[model samples]
Target: MVSRELIARHCICCGGGNLEKSPAVLMPFVALRVFGHEPVEITEDWGLRDLRQGMAYTLCNSLQCQNCGALFLDYRFTDEQMEALYRNYRDELYNEQRIRFEPGYANVPPHYHQRANYLCEVEAWLAPYLPEAPAVLDFGGDSGINSLFREHNQLLHIHDISGVELVPGAERADLERIRQCHYDLVTCSQVLEHVPYPLDFVKQMLPALGTGSLIYVEVPHEALLRAHPGSLQLATCKRHWHEHVNFFTESSMRVLLESLGLVVVDVLHLPVDIGWTQGEVMGLLARQA
Candidate 1:
């Protein structure tokens, strides 16, 4: 019998029940790389017992939506599981545990503290669509370190679950405050890939937008997906599931935004050089219709 949590009942992007399945593994360590890890005996110490099968690493399927071409892990993680996986969130403690599991894992924290180089280009691309001094809200933007238009924005708000300290000039906000206040632009960057339900996640931010307010969503155009463009056979290529579970295609992204009653103003594939790696980002700029 398969664990109910390991079954994807419907397409997360298009709500389609028809999906194709392929073999994939849920890495116990939750590190980025799927291969070249030091073989360590699986144990409950990693805190993924519920997801494991009698001390064996969890073997699961990758489901691809036939309707929209979105590839994602078949497993639907619970809120508690998500919290446990991201408790320290790349801090020293988190890195120590991860390094213990995969010695090849680079223990150095990826530049979460530094502002991303791509945001400058992102801000420029969005300049024409936004007000001169937009009230910006960065949902899931940790520390507001890379919030776009920071200097020019009338107000910069950071709404994140990580509980990381905000940089100077960035105000912290809760969901209720987000509902009460309207923002000219809400940026959900580099976050959709990790979420189980992208549609529901974006829907939560809808109330913050008044008419014509724009939401900028960015996700990595994962190497596998880009290499096999328009091919639904990505499940075969993506044999391991890490923090980034959902692999979005341009068609799938458009479907997600349109289903939410948002107008897709533009979809761009932007090049990025983030010190550690050079890759592409799929940026979707949408507005309340």
Candidate 2:
């Protein structure tokens, strides 16, 4: 017997309307054959892989949330399914496998030594809002590569699905522990898109902070994607399209933030000069109101 799962009633962001499902555009994998040379790559088999086999691709349909402009799959996978996906979510698999990176990522400038430079950029951006040795909560900060406070004596905590947590001077950011006190800043980069409900993700994280606390969010500049739909599909495909269900534009992001009682301080359109992926990423700085 098939089990019945609860459906998300309205737009996860705006709570305004039903999410509309759209058709699939791109495929992440290529053909493998004995005679033809196969290119080595590391790609998570996002439910969309098998048709010949009995495995199913439940969310091949795109669920676009018109109210807040978040386009994602409408289906809410069960905890069991989610566990299966993230239980073995390895951050280093891509590196350990030495999977050939997309030409765009390897040819990108920010790819090499990006961790250090990224920290510098983040430091500069948060300088105004951050106090010396400020407490930082790195939500979904994989292996803490995006943290800038480790060098300083600042308190930095990382919470991620990846089982491994290894960042110097950084402790595990437990959700319950985070709620104990307000933090100086919160950073979530390249994470919102992965979540099924962007609003719930923010809400869960928001309680850990309070008014005057700052939140820094970075996502693919999907607004820029309007100009290149094909590239958008390919980008999502290369980035593991199944995992990234929500697509947000700048205006949509602002709407979502403002609805949550946050003030948008800044928005940035970050175009890649170097990296395994080539595209525009939007950065937003907001303060809890």
**Candidate 2 lDDT tens digits, 1-289:** 1122235546656665645655452223211111122333334553446434332222245555555556555455555555554543533543332224233333343443356344556566668767887888888887786665767636888888675746668888678888886778888888887666676577667887776688888887654356744332422332224455567767668887887778899887766533355567778888877
lDDT of 1 by residue, 49-168 (tens): 466634445677888988889999987766766787778787787788787766766734666567888888989999999889999999998888888888889999999998888888
| Residue pairs in collision within model 2 | 105-275, 105-276, 105-277, 108-274, 108-275, 109-274
**TM-score, every prediction:** 0.88, 0.69
lDDT of model number 1:
0.83
Candidate 1 worst ten-residue window by lDDT: 31-40
lDDT of 1 at 174: 95
Worst 10 residues of 2 by lDDT: 27-36
For model 1, the stretches where C-alpha displacement exceeds 4 angstroms are: 1-6, 31-56, 107-110
Which one wins on lDDT? 1
Residue 202 of model 2 has an lDDT of 73
Q: What is the lDDT of residue 44 in candidate 1?
A: 66
